[model samples]
Structures are given as structure tokens and as C-alpha cells.
Target: MSSNQAFESAKQEYEQWGINIDEVFKTLKNIPISIHCWQGDDVGGFEVNRGELSGGIDVTGDYPGKARTPEELRADIEKALSLIPGKHRINLHAIYAETDGQVVERDKLEPKHFEKWVTWAKEHRLGLDFNPTLFSHEKAADGLTLAHPDPEIRQYWIDHCKASRKIGEYFGRELGTPCLTNIWIPDGYKDTPSDRLTPRRRLMEALDEIFAEEIDKNYLVDAVESKLFGIGSEAYVVGSHEFYLSYALKNDVNCLLDTGHYHPTEMVSNKISAMLLFFDQLALHVSRPVRWDSDHVVTFDDELKEIAMEIVRNDALDKVMIGLDFFDASINRVAAWTIGTRNMIKALLFALLLPHCQLKELQENGDFTRRLALLEEFKTYPFGVIWNQYCQEMNVPAKESWLQDVQKYEEQVLSKRS
Candidate 1:
């Protein structure tokens, strides 16, 4: 067929799939919604509509952010948790850009920061997903270096993974953090579709080494992450559920779902959510995504929220942890957390509101749009409207730097009027 004919055919197929969003709204009237915590970015171009409601928040800390001062930060976090309805934790996809040391050397700061952070998680009952960027220099590489080629690196991972297991075992004991031992390499191509199979194979080898040893001794830290690109075109990481699972080994492996990593064409359906059940461990990622960009915000709309929560609610999945992958400028902290958490609750509330029979059939049959209008209707409903309300209600301070944005906008408006 001609290109125009192909386009028409595809449109026709999509038209059938498209449901009446209005009708979905009709179904979503006044459903209650809440999220444990979220990283919203309303200050940035990404508007997180949700922070109006019930839930705690997990946004970034400042200048060296809270991670730099784990103790004071942890105490602050624990206080916030106590104040809010629920407080969920988040692991930054990348640690600070300045981390060139192996560990954030306990003695590096005027007062050691690492020990305090360890103390905080231990005291507060917060679970963690440790993600160290491979970009950090040798001392800070967390023992495994991504600088090597696949063949050489595979062995390095094998060796390094042993140390990771030991460290994880210690952390688990010290902090009593349940999940431990996870790793993801940012070693994918920039320009050409470089060593596609090599990195994946090395990743597999590293995991196998960790699993064979770690699983029996203590709970193996679940390896969970998806594919994404930073600079160039080749996004070779595990970008989708189908592809993520395709390479997944049969033993001790778990599924990790990242929201922003997917190609625009990917869809998260009930059936897709069902696949997560196969893993011994599963975790859902929260990140804001637009057409081509992953902004990492909190408030996502109907379709985006639905597919995400369906995976979360699947009873079959074990150790179902939900965490945020927020990537906004450092200044918009409260808004980011508020909006992100609010959207998260909306997702959970969406699941709570659904009729068991209908939801089940929808999951079994993959009838996605059936929930679309209802989901949208949530924005108008008390729950959705309340997310923003809750954010406003919270005494949480806004980012100091972002306050300047208000003055600038006001000045521009006054000038225009004059």
C-alpha cells in the first residue's frame, strides 16, 4: 500500500481503540485518590496537577541536597513522614554529579554524612533502592566500573558483584533495609547502535554471580531498571516490559518498570501489568513522560496513571514497591513531591474505585479505555481536585530559588500593562 494508504489504515485502527474520554470522566466521579509520595515539577514546564490531596512527599533536598547530610536530612524526612498520611522513599536514578569517591567517605564532610543517612533509614522504617551512577569516579564507582569493554567488564562485574553482595549483606543487617543488591549500568551507545548484545550479556553475568551467592545468604537485592538514552539516539537499555522480560533470567530475578524509559509507542495494559507477577520481586517506577521527553513529575493523567497502577495492584507480584524517578530542576522541590504523591494516590484510588468484576474483565481482555473517562473525571472529582488542595495545605516550604520566578513573571506582567 502507499504511504498515505498506510497512514489512513493506521488511523482507522486507532480510531477504534480511542474511547470517549468524556464517558470515562462520567464514570470517574468523586473517587478518592492518594499517593505515598511523589516528585512533582510544577515549577518547571511540567505541571503536576495532583499535589492537591492525601499523601506524604519525597522530593529532592538542596545543594549538596539532603543526601549530602544524611542525618539531618533523614530526621527531616522522618518528621515529614510523621506529619503526612504516608511517606514513601525514592532512589535518585543518578546520584550527585560530583561523586568521584567510591563511597561518600564517612569523614569527607566537617561531620560525617554517610553514617547519619544509614542511621535515618534504620530508624525510620524506609525501604531503599540503591542506584549508583556509573559516571562517578573510581573510589565512588561502588566497586563496579562501567568503563571497561563487555568481555573484560563481565569478569569485573562478576568480581565486583561479590563485593556488592557483601556490602549489601552488611547494609541489610545494619539498616535492616529489606531489599538489597541492585545494579544498573548506564553503558549504552551514544551515536551508533554499538555493542548491543555485549552489555546485556555482561549485565546477565553480573546478576548471575550475585544471585548464585547472594540469594541464599540474604535476600538478593532485586536488579530492576529500564532502558533510556541521555545524549544520542541509541537507547539500548531494557526499555519496555516485553523486552525487559525477554532477557530476564528464570531464577531469582524480579521485574522493574520505569515510566519514562519507554518509547512513545509503548503501552502499559492490564495484560502487561500481569506479566510482573512472574517475577519473585517487582517494583513500579514513577516518572513524568511527555511525547519525547521524560520530565519526571508527579501528576500524570488518566491513561498514564492507569497502566502504571494496574501493574502495582496485581496481587500476584511480590514485594511490590512503588518509588519515584523524578528529574526536575532542584528548585521546585515541594511542588514536585506534592504533585508526584498526589498522582500516585490518584492511581491507587483509581484501582480502589473500579468494580472488581469490570476491572478483572478489563485486565483479562485488555480493555484499557474503559477506565479512561473515569480516570479523567477524577480531576474534577474531590480526590483529584484535592491533590492540589493538599499540597497547598502542607506547610512544606517552596524552593527558595523558584520564588524569584514569581517576581520575574509579575514584573513582566506589570511592564506589559504599563
Candidate 2:
């Protein structure tokens, strides 16, 4: 059957469950997923004096055609954005700053360093987000940044974060969209540490210093991310979930939840509702974890669906700031971005199409049997047909047809990168 005919049939099926598919489309188009820029270059930013990847983060595989420059990275991102449906934002790190071959320290970074990025974002009508790079620097060589015991080192990172927030505010002011500036540091000991409280205390003080200057919330939003454990920090991490949860709540800042930053059994989906109860808003770093906090590309798994459902059902779509955060250098870099981001949008679409109110009613009325049956039965619903329709309406290729574009781009553009 033709795609339109298939969609018509699927639309009728969903309509029977009282789902307004038209409304779902309208809502879905407004939800923008912040696509991370690092995926195009495997977290290797364009720093003149670039150092090796450090601070428990690693991007493996020697994938050819990885973006080596800021221009190339932006082009690759453009290609991926063309394939993905809907308008989205680009998330950038401090290391991606362009200093014209001059070695600019992180603390000294200014808005002019990202003029090209702001121009590109304006040209494409895209929003921009920022992150303070707290890893892969000589200062963070020991896997400690803000939490470093040395007063001078902590002050340096604190200054870097303060500078990053200004750049974020610049993007927001120029683009007319509030920028989300997130801070994630890899400061933890490989083994157990006797003085855990001291490092956390130092981190708290550093953060206070970084956020001491009051920037208008209309321009820039601040966030802090927490990690359970990482490559080097197996025993203890200074920015534990509990630490940031309390900090974010007390300080009126957003706490970012990375899907891969928790234990294997602890799901981020389960934490969404609880977080919304206290905070006015929260943020997410959607990623997949394989065994450990391995930054694998996001997949449309149960957890992803549940996460989307939590956002949609709780009516917290505006309250939750969603962004992609994964770097996989094993496959085509552009394809990695396309696949992960498409899956994230797909999960949201799936959540939007569900009869959330009816399901809640069933559960509240103690109709567990019917609820379970209906949930399983809906799994076989014509979700793909609706997704294909979304892609078609968004003027992007539907289904696996987008892969052909990626392949063609690979041959024409990416393969010639080196």
C-alpha cells in the first residue's frame, strides 16, 4: 500500500483509542532535541594545543572521515540535520572554540571565538547550547577539575565555567533563544579516597564562585551534571547524583540526568517524575550505556520509550530539556548522529501516540489485567506508519531511505575529508 493509505489506516486505528494524531504531530514538531556536536568528531574538538582525551572519557575506533576542523564538523552536522525531521539545536563544548591557531586557555574563551558558530546557527535557524569543557586538559590530567584540592586549579576551572556561561548567554541573545550551559566534570579517584567530603566541599565552593555572578535567566540557563563512576573513578565520584540533586534544588539550578551516568539497574526514566516534583525544570543527556557508562549511541529501547512516556504523560515536555550525548567512532560519524537522534524523536512520537490518560485511568481503577493487555497489544500498533508520515510531512526521507542519503554523502563529502 502507498504510505498515505497506510497512514490513513493507522490514523483510524489510533483515533479509535481517542488519540489525536494531528495534535501529536503539532506537539512533536515543537519538541527540539539538542544534537551534540562532538558526535561528528568523536569528542576531538578543534583546539590548537589539543591534548589527548582524558578524565575517564574515551572515544574508540579509528573511523576515517572524522571531522578534523570546525568548518568540517559544522558541515557534517548540517548533513545529519538535513536528514533528521524537525528543527533541532546544536550542543557545543568549550573545546570547540576557534582561536585562529592561537592557543587560548579555557578560562579566557570569549563570544567572538564562536562567531562562526553563531552565524551558522542563525543561517540555519537553529538554537545553540553550550558546555564548559572540564576534561582532556593538562589541569584535568589527574581526573580532577572543580573538585581538585589545589586552590589555583579549582579557581581556573571555576573561571572557565564562568566564561562558558557568558558565551552561552551570547548565543541566546543573538539567536533569540535561551541557551542551556551545562557543567560536567570528571573529578573522582580511581580507588577509594579517605577524604571524599573534602573534594565535594571544594567542588561546592568552586561552583558557588562560578555562579556568583548573576546572569539573566532569560538569556542563559545553568545546569550541573552528575556521574556515578567512570573509567578511572571506579570507587567514588565527587559529583554524585545525591550531591547534585541537593545542590540543584537548593541553588535553583537545573540538574542534568545522563542516561549512562547511573548504575546498570537504575533507570533514568524512573527518576523523571520524582525530579519534576521538586524542581521547576530539569535537563537530560540522552545516551545508551553498555554494561558501564559507555557512551554508545542512543537506541529506541524500553528505557527510551519509558523516558519519553514520562515526559509526555506527566505533561513535562516543556519542563524537561532534552539533548543527545553519545560519541561512537566505530561507524560513520554522520550516520551515528542520524541514528541516535532519529531514535530519540521516534521514542517521543511513540509516547505521544499512546492513550496515556486511559492507561492511567486503568491503573487507578485497579484494572491491571486490562492495562497490561492493552499495553502489549499497542506495541504491535502501526507506529512506523505514523513515523513515516512524520518524516514525509517534515520533508525528510522516511524509513531507511534516509540511509541512502547518508551513504551518498559519505562518498561525496565525508570520504574526501582526509
What's each prediction's clash count?
Answer: 28, 0
The TM-score values for the models, in the order shown, are 0.61, 0.99
Q: Please, what are the lDDT tens digits per residue for candidate 2 over residues 104-191?
A: 9999999999999999999999999999999999999999999998889988999999999999999999999999999999999999
Go through the candidates in order and give each one's C-alpha lDDT. 0.43, 0.95
Give the clashing pairs for model 2.
none
**Residue ranges of candidate 2 with Cα displaced over 4 Å:** none
- lDDT per residue for candidate 1 within 26-106, as digits (tens), equals 322322122222232211111111122111112333312222222323332343343333344434212311232334321
Name the candidate that leads on TM-score.
2
